[model samples]
Target: MFGEYRTLSAKPGYSYTYTDGWTLSANPVYSYTYTDGWVYHGRSRYSCESVIRIILAETSLRSTVQREDALNNKIRAAKKLADIDSNSSQLRQLKQLEKELEKLKKTRADQVRTLYEWECMLRVGSLRRGYISVKSNPAWYLREELVEDCISRGGCCSRDCGCCERRRLSAKNGKGIGHCTLECMCCIHDQGSEFTAEEKKDFNGRFGKMLRSNNPAFLLRITNAYFSKPLFWKIKTKHK
Candidate 1:
């Protein structure tokens, strides 16, 4: 039955052979087996947990850097604006922004120091003897309370009080009372006449102390301190 048997050698092997209308082929077939060493797919890789931790750390660092850069840019802008014109309407806003930036810088520095302390504590495997810390002095609360009382009794000429009538009158008459130089006494006296002698004495004692300690900037400082009282109290409570 080998009618067309032909021996065709190509590189010491036959490329194709036909015998009795049948075809025979010789080709290698590769196969793979699953083994313990083959589970890694021939690549070095980190564990899933490690990869997740790395990603989180990188994201946190990037966000922190961006926040710091934004704060710095805002500070620079405020400084530039403040320097451009002292009499501009935005002068107050620029000054306030500068003050806020300074506070933020101090806050950031404190946070970094606190973090370093905690890291050190963790490394040493010990706790601090007393972890309590004060964010603000207790004296600030007392001062704020005194200022609020004085303000309510018209010892300080708040905008909400009847003492504003004096300002309106002065403005109408074109006479500046120079309230800063006079310790705001002009407006206070105009409103104080309605209060009892005891009330007036108490107001005078507290207001006088404030004036003597900080003659020019007392009002501004007291106002800011009063407003910040709640924040200080919150921090104190957290520490406690």
Candidate 2:
């Protein structure tokens, strides 16, 4: 089980995970300047604020992906059940769910395109007061709380189904192998219930609470880890 965050290292490109434990943050560091060729392209300039916003958007986009993904899996599970026990009401519900999922997929597509463009705009970027340097761990979301929370959300972690341990590369993540999201079909199938609007609001609150003003360092650390875009946090020599 992975531990929660611990102290941050002073190094510009690395963080400590308790060595056998964990924590996170970064100190003030150099910033970035766009290269001349980048300017020649007449692209809108990048800023530290812009980068932060992009990272936040990435987090939100992942939520969108997870929602749709969960719904998609639920549809599959529903279909299987419908096959076993045919019900016109169930079939109709499945159709409606499929429709909703398509809408979400379209929204996700739009976000993905916009995010890709923004990321390209600042693909070569950095921080003002610090840098993001999460190590290359094939498995992210190792924090014990994240997994435990998964069970709380009725994820498969609570059972021998082994879904949480499946080394999943969720549509919700780019490079991290992590626990189940609202998207775990096994959990939804077993529970026979979906997340309510209030619960989803609560989950969103908990998920993004770290970004509060009181914990800006954590914001950077999570941003770095989730987006897997540390190269953007690298310090660049003043672009000549």
Candidate 3:
């Protein structure tokens, strides 16, 4: 149940009229539905609508950090928030990230006791591994909507240089990958900066909010993207 790249209508009360004739209106508090059991089963992570999670989590460079620290501090699990320094940056380094990721998977496997409910409450990490890791094709990762999401946030994808589509990560050994990360060179070149640890946390947290949010398409994207075998349910977000 991966998401296809579609131009998301962001006007008031965006609606999705699926091919099966179900009309869904999207609101931040919108929800995902099972819809006659047209759903994927026995999957742990990844939505079929894969566009690379880094863009979703790294955020556009134009992002401004809200003073969520104060708000988060009030929560019982705020320290966990404080302790987070987004590993999204490390993900860009390619070779450096393998061992760290393997360790994380094992840890996540343990913590996924009640999957969906747990994710809804607090989504700390991202599902960066798409359904397939094609290793370096911009076309593979370039879901334009995601690029637009990056552009909206003032990332390198927003630029005319085509950096987002360039194979810069591991190109020599034929494993070169593309797409923007928190530490993209062009992004750092133009913006003259990379995300600070807190900024990356804030950036990553914003995407986490989307997963935890009620936006139907968004929730569906995440649920499909990061499915954890938890019980799925319908969340009604239609307005009267």
Candidate 4:
């Protein structure tokens, strides 16, 4: 019956609600809840495999974007310096950047090709290998879409929410962009807690039950990525 519903295209920074209601934000980080709500589901094992592949793809994208941005910055600096002062160091740096840009051009092409291949594989492999494609994997795709949609929708919350919160919390705050993390934490925590009596009554009157999940394993796995921060420095020290 759920599958019978027509699939509607949604815009970035906006998710489709059951009715015509617009959710506050599309970012899954900010969105309190979303599940397929459809009866169809992927097997847990296959879902995990699909998620890992998606993660690999995502990591590659993040790494490439960072490198490209860094390269662009270097090129800009080199150009600026070349205009002002054509010193030996500046010339050498400019030449090195030219070489780096060539390398990155090749690298970008390869990555794009690889991603296209992965996209094809994900689409076709689902039937042959029983793995869901990114399009078919609703849960995984939801998170991925949320991030991109958030980034595309002005790359900040100030536009969506009335809070006008910026990336930096305070000048003295050592943890850059920690406010975002804190905001997410509080939002999730509050959602887990008591809502207003009217809200509770309304939800109960509608769904006849409080929303809750019995899956501790799933919770741990989702939050594990956040837990690795403390170990990063130690890991780097050991590697060095």
Candidate 5:
């Protein structure tokens, strides 16, 4: 006579099985076992913030470019009118438009410089803080997802999304929630080697050129390309 028997055990977190016959065997199974800590979670948060900042900066740049273009068109129209009629009023109007164009160019340069500086500050802060822990609970992830969805859809229109509130808070603090503040002296210490002044200037120059470029589409493309790259935390696996 021959006989065979099998036993199976299952639990919320894990499972196992055993079989007895001509041969015996045991098997173990686990549903989910990976735990992500502060570094992993913080990196994700920072990456998302970076992407959002790039998008916002690009949008602002595009708007400014459009305004500059409109002003140029107006100046051209004024010049053409002056050329055809040669009246004192037309001449004055042409000169005024020229002065306005110069002011607009200066304003655009300042805007670009400000955006570049903000980007530098963000990167510098990240380097200094390393990855600080934050609340990565389900509720937090849900809120983050909601915000991302709203951004993808152009913007959140409903108050329930809390997008406006989040923006207001960020603006008030000049940093994202859960970020380590300058007051946290320990946290302000550089996690990596500090960037040299020359390196910092070079970085600013590169971004300055990109931001000042008249081609809005090219700038948008570059921004999108940057955000499309895989984040470091995504590809890294930790064994525990």
Candidate 6:
């Protein structure tokens, strides 16, 4: 019996019986075990089924969660676009604000350019007169008799007559003013002095040359700029 039991235990799918003190235990070759002819051990098929089911449940839950997240992302994007479209007034206001900002920027740039031009002109005028000993203020120069009488009263050459408003009104009926009428009028009014005889001759020669040049615009430019003031006097002479 012992030999048969050992042979059965070694077989691939065979059952055996072992007895001890009147107790009999069956050993299953595929699924059961008997230890010391008393204890029986076997495994149930449902033991692995729970673990397999748990893995499948986890995989299914993860797939569902992924699908839900994708759907939510698409919905969020669509809602954002719809909200933008619905706020038409806000969009128009934003565009208007941009235009206003651009206009303000352009206005600021123009102001800066205008200030720069004024600064340039002032600097240029200062440099032109810097080295010259005599400086003429534009306002006083405008009111000067040499400039004003040359434009309004033609000329004056009397040695004792004043060139002020009262003297001019009083002398309007006198004989034609002299050659140095402008100078005499200035001197009589205590405003200027007489030029020397040599200076007078030199002025006549220079003025005659300029007139004979026959460049219409050149004379006009000189007249407008110098305006009866001596040609060489107006030119800024370097003192240093």
Deviation (Å) of 239 in candidate 2: 45
Give the C-alpha miss distance for residue 210 in model 3, angstroms: 1.1
TM-score of every candidate relative to the true structure:
0.24, 0.52, 0.38, 0.39, 0.35, 0.20
lDDT value for candidate 4?
0.35
Against the reference, the lDDT scores of all candidates come to: 0.34, 0.50, 0.38, 0.35, 0.37, 0.32
Q: Which candidate tops TM-score? A: 2
* Residue-by-residue lDDT tens digits, candidate 4, 45-164: 122233334334443543344445446677898899899999999999899988987887677567656655654554432222323322232222223223333334333332353121
Q: Write the per-residue lDDT of candidate 2 for residues 169-191, one digit (tens) a residue.
A: 44345522345555445655786
User: Best-fitting candidate, measured by lDDT?
Assistant: 2
Q: Per-residue lDDT tens digits of candidate 3, residues 194-229?
A: 568898777778766665444446555434323221
Pairs with steric clashes in candidate 2: 5-22, 5-23, 6-22, 6-23, 17-21, 18-21, 18-22, 28-129, 29-129, 70-183
lDDT of 6 by residue, 1-240 (tens): 111212212122323454555766543221112211111111111121222222223223322232233334445555566577847765565555555545644544454454334323432221223212122322212233334333443333222232322332222122111122323423323544545769756764665455334333323232223212222243111120
Q: For model 4, what is the alpha-carbon lDDT of residue 26?
A: 20
- Model 5 Cα lDDT, one tens digit per residue, 1-240: 001111211221212223344544322111111121011111222333353354445445433444455467778888888788989998988888888778867766766776566566555443223212112221221233234433443333222334333332432122222211111112213323334558646755665565434433333333322322212122111110
Off by over 4 Å in 6: 1-164, 172-182, 188-193, 218-240
Model 4: colliding residue pairs: none
Q: Model 5 reaches what TM-score against the true structure? A: 0.35
Shift in Å, residue 193, candidate 1: 52
Clashes of each: 0, 10, 11, 0, 0, 4
